[model samples]
Target: MYYINKITFSMFITITLLWSITLTRIYAESRECDHTKCVKTLADTTIDMLIATRSVVAKNQDLINVDPVSGNYYFKGFVPAMVGSEVANDFSLMTGHKLKQTSLKLRNPNNAPDEWEEKVLRSFEASGYPKGAGFGEALVTGDNKIYRYMKPIYVEKACLECHSTKKNLRPEIRKFLEERYPYDHAFGYKEGDVRGGISITLPFGN
Candidate 1:
C-alpha cells in the first residue's frame, strides 16, 4: 500500500508538470500572435499614410521643400525617414523611437555611400527571404526595449525619371537633390529593382 501511494503521488506530480508546460506554450503562442497582429496593423496604416502623402507630394511641386518651422521636408529623398516620421506621428503617436528609411542602389563600383545599405542587403539574403523584395520586423537591443520594422521599396517605371543612372533627370529636380543631398546615393535605380527600405522603430516596453 505504501509503494502504491508513492507511485500515485509521483504520477500526480508528473501530470501537473505536463499541464504547466502545456499552459505555458499556449500563453506564449497567444502573445506572439497578438504581437504579430499589432505590428501588421501598424504597418498597414503606415503604408496607407505614406502612399497618400507621396501622391500629394508628387503632384504638388511647392510643398517639396523643408518646412521652415518644423525643419522637416514633406518628401525627403530618404524614403525610410519619411515613412518613419509618418508612422511615429500618426500611428505610434510619437511613442518610442521614430521609423527610418534608407535606400540602396546598385553599387556604382566606384563609391558606395553608407554601410547600412550593404548590411540591409546581406541581412535580407541571410534571412532566406527574397533578395530584392522583402519586409519584416526585428528587435533592437539596448535594454531590449526597441523594435525596428523594415520593408523594401522597389523602383517602378515612374521612379526612373529621377532615379536612373542616366542623367536625363529634370534640371530643377536634379538641382534640388544636389543641394539637399550632396552625397546622395539614392539614385541609379531601374523599375522593379530594389531601391532601399523603410524602417520603423517602436518601443517594446510600451
Candidate 2:
C-alpha cells in the first residue's frame, strides 16, 4: 500500500508539471501575437500620417517658387525623400522604434536593406498587392526579441519630378541629383509605382 501511494503521488506531480508547461507556452504565444498586432498598427498609422503630410506638401507646390537652377517647383524646400528620412529619424527618437524608408534603388544609401528586409521587399513585389495595402511579418531578432511591420510606399505625380528618368527631369534637377547622389537609381519611377517601403522595428521589450 505504501509503494502504491508513492507512485500515485509521483504521477500527480508529473501531471501538474506538464499542465504548467502547457499553460506557459500558450501564454507566450498569445503574448507574441499581441505584440505583433500592436506594432503593426503603430507602423501603419505612421505611414498614413506620412502620406497625408506629403500630399499636403505636394498640393502646396504651386505656391512655391521654382528652383532657379532646376526650373521645377521647390516644394517649399520640402523634398519628399529628404523629408521622409528626417521624419523617420525624428519618429524613431520619439517612439524608440527603428523606422526607415528603404528601397532597392536607393536615393539615400542609408535606406539599403538588410537580409530580412530584402526578402520582405521581394515578397511584396511578388504578392501583387496594391501599394497602399501593406504587409508585415513577425521575426525574432538575433537577441531573440520580436520585430515586426512593413508598409509599401507608392510614387505620386509629385514624386516624379525627382524620381523620374533623366529625360523627364529638368537640367538643374538632373545636375542636382548627380551632385547629391552620383549613383542614383531611384529615378525613372512613374506615378502609382511601388517606389519603396517603410519598415518599423518595434522595441525589444514589447
TM-score of each: 0.53, 0.71
lDDT of 1 by residue, 5-120 (tens): 33334533553454345334432332343365565545444444444444333433333334445644333343323433444354333233354445554322322324544576
The candidate that wins on lDDT is: 2
Per-residue lDDT of 1-206 in model 2, one digit per residue for the tens? 01223333453355345434533443344335456566566557656666655555455444433554555554233456665576667666654567787887888787898877777777777756665777776766676565666777778888787788888876757777788787778988988887877787764344
Show how many residue pairs clash in every candidate, following the order shown: 3, 1
Best-fitting candidate, scored by TM-score: 2
lDDT of 1: 0.49
TM-score (C-alpha, index-matched) for candidate 2:
0.71
How far is each candidate from the true structure, as Cα RMSD in Å?
21.2, 21.1
Clashing pairs in 1: 80-100, 80-101, 81-101
